[model samples]
Target: MQRSKLVSQILEKKNYLCVGLDTDTEKLPAHLKNKPDGIFEFNKRIIDATLEHCVSYKINTAFYESMGTKGWEIMQETFNYIPDSHFKIADAKRGDIGNTSHQYAIAFYETLKADAVTVAPYMGEDSIKPFLSYKDKWAIVLGLTSNAGSKDFQQLILSDTGKPLYETVLETVAKWGNIDNTMFVTGATKADFFEDIRSVVPEHFLLVPGVGAQGGSLSEVSKKGANKDIGLLINASRAIIYASGGEDFDLAASEAAKEICNEMKGYIV
Candidate 1:
């Protein structure tokens, strides 16, 4: 997925919504839970229902990885099911030393064929550089995450820089890769910091989680986080995918996604 193609899709769709397939097997519709391929079935339905409303789909690997080999197969199948017209992301949050990170990159970018993979940056440039080596693939580094625990470290003001650690992260990490292959994960819950985030990397795309189920205000993020290309992949997982727990789950998911997409249309300008 080229940066230009992603922006073109966003503009054409009038929404930057990135539906997250954070499909929890325990939370699947009662009817589908007992089936052999229930997880993939759920994902297939969700992808089919919401295809028109979003420009991307983020498949959170944790949910699948927990299922072991079967889960990995399902994850790969789900990735294959997604249309190439939309950006596909593997939310693995993986990072390690150089050689290890290369393997992680291969797992997500090569094996799973995802357009992007979410990565942790605690290990510094070596941990993140491998993911950026692929031409059009992206490494979505954690900037200021939506999780509450993010406060413990990301917000700490550095003695040398006189700026929050996340700010320093944004400044330094932005230099490691160009906008085409680099993006930052700034949680929608951390909406307050979006303005400051943009000040450092205005042109890079942002993978924004915590929007729907996490209670982050979409409007606030849109107003503060959007770039010239509307560079925000606003992800709504449980809110949309698990909208209903019955036979009508697909329809419910479609409506849920459509509603968010509609709200997004208003913020596009």
Candidate 2:
């Protein structure tokens, strides 16, 4: 999807929620566990139920990859079910050298047909540049992630730069691709630092996780991170998708998503 079109969708919907499809087979409803295509069936319902409340869908590849070939097939089927009007993201977090990275890009962008794929920037420019080369597609590099382990390296203060490594990352990576094709995975748990991060890459979009189940504040992230175009994709996974374990799971998910959308409407510019 083009950057302009994504922005248009956000404005048109009055929200920027991105539902995370981190479906776990073991955690699926009891009835679905016995089905031949349980995972895909669960995903189809979640997508259908929440479609009206979100402008994007992010599929965490690990969940699908775990089931092996059948899982991969289910992942592709779920991707196909998502409407093109909303941005599709494959949360693969893949990063490697030039040739290897090119194949990863092809797997997500060409094979899976995702509009964006999360990437790790620890390997530096070459590992990330290939994804940026694709027009209208995005390379979502990890900046300040929400994981507890992020403090181990991402927040380290480098002697040479005298700044948290993540700040340098935000500044350096922003130069590799324009605001149109580049986005940073700035965790919602780091809302306090959004103002500082925004100073580094004000125009680039930020894929924010941790808002719901992780206890990150939506209003705080919006107040500090949003630009004139509302450059944020706040994702809620377990909190929405697993809102219920019974037959009403789809309705529960829809209600959870709608609640978030309502909060987002107040924050949208």
Candidate 3:
């Protein structure tokens, strides 16, 4: 999906909510725990229930990968079930040497056909350049993440530039790919820094993942992070996906998604 189309969807739906599909069998309702395709079944219902309220769906590849081959099959099935109008994301956090990155790019871009994939930029330009080569696909680079350990590296001041590691990353990588194909992951927990991060890369979109279960404030994030295009994809996973542990899980998920979407609508331009 082109960036314009994504923007349009957000505006048309009055929401920029991205539902995270971090499906885990252990967390599945007891009724589905013994089902043959529990993961896919859970995802299908979540998609069906919340598709109208959300503009995107993010599938954390690790959850599926841990289940091995069967997990992969279900992941593909879940991917196929999502409507084409909604953006599909593979939260793979893949980054490696150029050659390996090329295969990773093909896996998510060609094989799984995800609209975007989260990428770790620690490997430098070569690790990310391959993913940018594809058309209408995005590389969502890790930036000021909400994790407690982000301060270890991303917050360190550069020796010469006097800017934080993430600031330098935003400046350097923005040159390699334009707004349409490149985006940064700025955790909603870092709401205060949104203004600072936006100062460096004001126009590019941000995939924010620290809301709901992580306690990231939506109002603060939107107030400081939004741009002329309202370039923010706020993701909520556990809070929405596991909103209930009973048979009404899908209904609960939909309700939770609607609550966030309604909140997001107020921030929409």
Q: How does residue 16 of candidate 1 score in lDDT?
A: 95
Segments in model 3 whose C-alpha atoms lie over 4 Å from true places: none
* lDDT tens digits by residue: candidate 3, 1-269: 89999998888888989999999889999999999977788999999999999999999999998999999999888888998999999999999999999999999989999999999989999999999998999999998999889899999999999999999999999999999999999999999999999999999999999998888999999999999888999999999999999999999999999999888878875
Tens-place lDDT per residue, model 2, 217-268, is 9989999999999999999999999999998999999999999999998887
lDDT of each: 0.94, 0.95, 0.94
Clashes of each: 0, 0, 0
Tell me the RMSD of model 1 versus the true structure: 0.7
- Please give the lDDT score at residue 159 for candidate 3: 92
Sliding window of 10 residues with minimal summed lDDT for model 1: 165-174
Q: Model 1: residues >4 Å from true position, as ranges?
A: none
lDDT per residue as tens, model 1, 153-215? 999999998999998988898999999999999999988889999999999999999988898
List the pairs of residues colliding in candidate 2. none
